[model samples]
Target: MKLRAYLLMLAVVGIWGCTFVLIKDALSDASPLAFNTVRMTLAFLVLAIAYRRHWREINRHQLIAGVIVGFFLAAGYQFQTAGLAKTTPSKSAFITGLVVVLVPLFSTVKALRPVGARAPRWNAYLGAFLAFAGILLLTVPAGSGVLPDFNAVNSGDLLTFGCSVAFTLHCIALGHTSPRIAFQPLALLQIGFCALFMMISTPILEHPQMRVTPRLILALAIAAVLATAAAFSIQSWAQSILPATHTALILTLEPVFAWITSFLFLGERMGLRPASGAIIILAGIAITELIPQPHVPTSHEA
Candidate 1:
């Protein structure tokens, strides 16, 4: 079952990885917030219909959990989309991948305990370090070297960093809540509330504009149906069985998938450095999965 959860998460990230290009293309025809609102709304409507019978099962705990998680979800997408509009895809991918590191950091917070945040194992930390290093190599331009030019910080990078934090919280929130609530209700409410938040924020944040182009429609359909609805549902189910840190570590593959998609569709070529980085990332994941975990005594046992 755990292996199945991991495989599901892998599939979820793969779907997400393909969306970077689609979203970039869609942004050409719609403002970021407007596009987000539309995609999320479409996703919510789809989930609502699919899980129509489960609406009555949602209780107050589920409602609160959904709202909290959905707010972070909306915030994460808002930052990521807006940032993508302003930054290069490589930079955006690297910054967004920082959630791998952020998850363990945020999980250590005492307040987040109610949301199922656990102190990551030592191997998880080591894995995150290697995975982040790999992400740096994979996403950083060849001539730019391993380190990003801090002196060249831009609004887009800052926004994408915000996305990393928001996504970290979203993961922890979902990890805690998913196991406690029914999957159908949990998935539906989160998608519904995320759409509501995006809809509410679109006008306040930007001048909403969209051109009804076929490209835009195609992006919306793929993003809403596959990426948002299906992917998020799978994530909720998977996270119920996997720890948030483990989930984030697996998600580090997103940039790798993005790179593969870019290579296949946009004729981008991977250099030696990125190829090596991909290998190191796999090594990191191996270490995390294969290393023996130190058993900690529960409070009662202690």
Candidate 2:
């Protein structure tokens, strides 16, 4: 089971790693919102066809919750996609990993107490710290002239920050998802909701005319089908049986994977500085988690 879970996580991470490049490429032919909407729409189609029978199982409450969750998901992608345009993949990935640090906070907010009914574990904190430190080194530019454009910000960096927060919230919502509802239906509903929001927002804010080409279409398909569907399904499956914090921590590796893949495929490279910063970020995150775990959670409590 442990191996399965880890492998699932690795697969998810690999798909997500490629996502940075895909998002960056897609933006050339479509607006941030449009790209997300179209991609999600395709994901919805893939899921819908696979689980046609599950449609009847989804209730009104599930639909409503799915739509709400989907909106946040779309928003997350919108910003991430936008952020990718201006920010380096390495920087964006590291920043997005902030979600790992936010989950317990959100859990606390919901319960009016610390999550896990205990302090974080020591190892988790150490891991988080290493990761974060690595990010800082990565982002501090090689020279003085690398200052970000203040007006638009790095669309990719800003978007990634948004995606991280929304993703954290989305995870919280998953705990509330009805067991009676199928994952496929709920996911489809959410994707549809995300697509709706993306399309609506695209024309209003950017108003950039898009000229779609074969490359654009191919990129969208990959993002929608492989990254969105495969990665998410695997993540959900793995986290369902693992400790939420542990699962969250494992996910913190995404930016690292993205940076590595981007360098290899997209020619986006991160020098030693930002790479070290990524380590720092990871270390900080590990510190936050590892510093507080008291005991194993009971199944009833989980």
- The numbered model that scores best in TM-score is 2
Q: Candidate 1 residues 182-225, lDDT tens each?
A: 77887788778989999999999999999999999999999999
- The runs of at least 3 residues in candidate 1 whose Cα sits more than 4 Å from the true structure, single-residue gaps closed, are 1-11, 114-118, 127-148, 236-250, 269-302
Candidate models: Cα lDDT each? 0.72, 0.66
Clashes of each: 0, 62
Model 1 per-residue lDDT at 302: 1
TM-score versus the correct structure, for each prediction: 0.79, 0.80
